[model samples]
Target: MACAWEESTKIRDVLIRPGTENDCNTIMDLIRELASFQGYPYAPQITAEILRRDGFGDNQQASFQTLLAVDRTTDKIIGYAVFFPFYSTWRGKGMFLEDLYVKPAHRKLGIGKLLLAHVSKRTLDSGGCQLRLSVLKTNPAKMFYSSLGFDNLTVDDGWETGRLDTNALEHLLESSGLTRS
Candidate 1:
């Protein structure tokens, strides 16, 4: 099985280091490619320019916390995980794993698990109360996350996720109707 193969290859020692500005392009490509694998395909609207500006930008709306895994032999970036901290009213502070992707060829090598372990350790190191993440209902990666000991927090009633499109966003802004003096 591909999953088994990915896991086995990942078992080998790999370094999980923090991502830097130099890694922006590679991370962007990986993000785009990984998104395509999950069915979406296109140049990421999040450009290298944007990555450099916002992620490492001047004012720093927020900071990007990423872990990059490098393959020893080829010295190529094989996997990455990005996460950030969040405030949980119910649980105080918690960390969110925003993205985790490992190249197919370098998978089964324990990269995914190691990536998770790295995040878990970082989360604990930061004095966070919990590690939280979201998964698409159709995403099979849920199995891998669950296998990593992350339990689902299901609400009793139906709690569905929702999002607003560009049109709706414009409508909301217009309705609120901010005007210059």
Candidate 2:
């Protein structure tokens, strides 16, 4: 839960583990940090309540999974990844990695790689054949991902990305003419 610290080569004792309901607040904080780093200080609106309700609710309606990397010495969660399953018409079941971030000070310590490896394994174990994520054009992590053999959809596969923000989403829904009975 704090900003990245100074970078060093010293040994970093870190542990990657499944995120629990108790971690919702910390996870949300880390997500805010990530948004600020990505040049969208006010982009993330997720709250701990939403996280707990959606991810750990009794109704079993969660849509995503989270894994956190904690610094063993400090017991602080310095990194995390959020992902979920999706169906692809061409590839069948797939996993979509929504976010992958490591504290600036915690970068280059192989924590990101370990997190990604865990997600990849989880995807395979869940009978998924594809893993997808979106990276910002200005982000330097693109190189790291490239080194890991991830293809750039735009360059490698000629795929373009699109999205609908909250306003557009509301407009679309209103225009769709669908309503509850």
Candidate 3:
């Protein structure tokens, strides 16, 4: 399915286009860069093969979609955004942006904003009513998102994010006597 922005969009020599299996390696590299920028304690467990399988493999198994921003002059990927459709009982259809990153050299050039605009456009085109994302409190991008009208739900609605790592999930399943068929 073509996104709303079917044609590759160029902003100051950067071309934004849909990501394909061929771009998985470059996308993995950008994912690592984003992990480093976020000061992740451990390296990301995702690999190009994983991205290719889960994102570009069988239609029923594909979990997400990606948009890549390439540097026109160098023909290299400089940024990417990963997103997927979701449903919210209260808000109806929505799009969740999993990651948005631009190479350090490309910051402050409106690339991030352009990427977001494309995501927003995609969300609206897909019958989604809202776009949502989570950002670390310490990340400077929080300010950028705020400037772009993203609300800090933690403050606005007192919502606390929760998570369960693999180990915790395993423990829950075992202790609860839940069996996966």
Give the C-alpha miss distance for residue 36 in model 1, angstroms. Answer: 1.1
* Model 1 ranges with Cα > 4 A deviation: 1-12, 154-157, 179-181
User: What is the full ranking by TM-score, best candidate first?
Assistant: 3, 2, 1
lDDT of 3 by residue, 1-181 (tens): 2432432334668888999999999899899989899999357898999999999996666899899888899999999999999899999999999999999987777889988999999999999999989998889999999898888889899999899998998898999999767
Name the candidate that leads on lDDT: 3
Candidate 1 residue-wise lDDT at 112: 83
The estimated TM-scores of all candidates read 0.83, 0.87, 0.89
Instruction: State the C-alpha lDDT per candidate.
Output: 0.81, 0.87, 0.89
Candidate 2 yields a Cα-based lDDT of: 0.87
For 58-84, candidate 2 gives per-residue lDDT tens digits of 888787999998888889998999999
Better candidate number, 2 or 3, judged by lDDT: 3
State which candidate, 1 or 2, has the greater TM-score. Answer: 2
TM-score of candidate 2 on Cα atoms, chains taken together: 0.87
TM-score of 1: 0.83
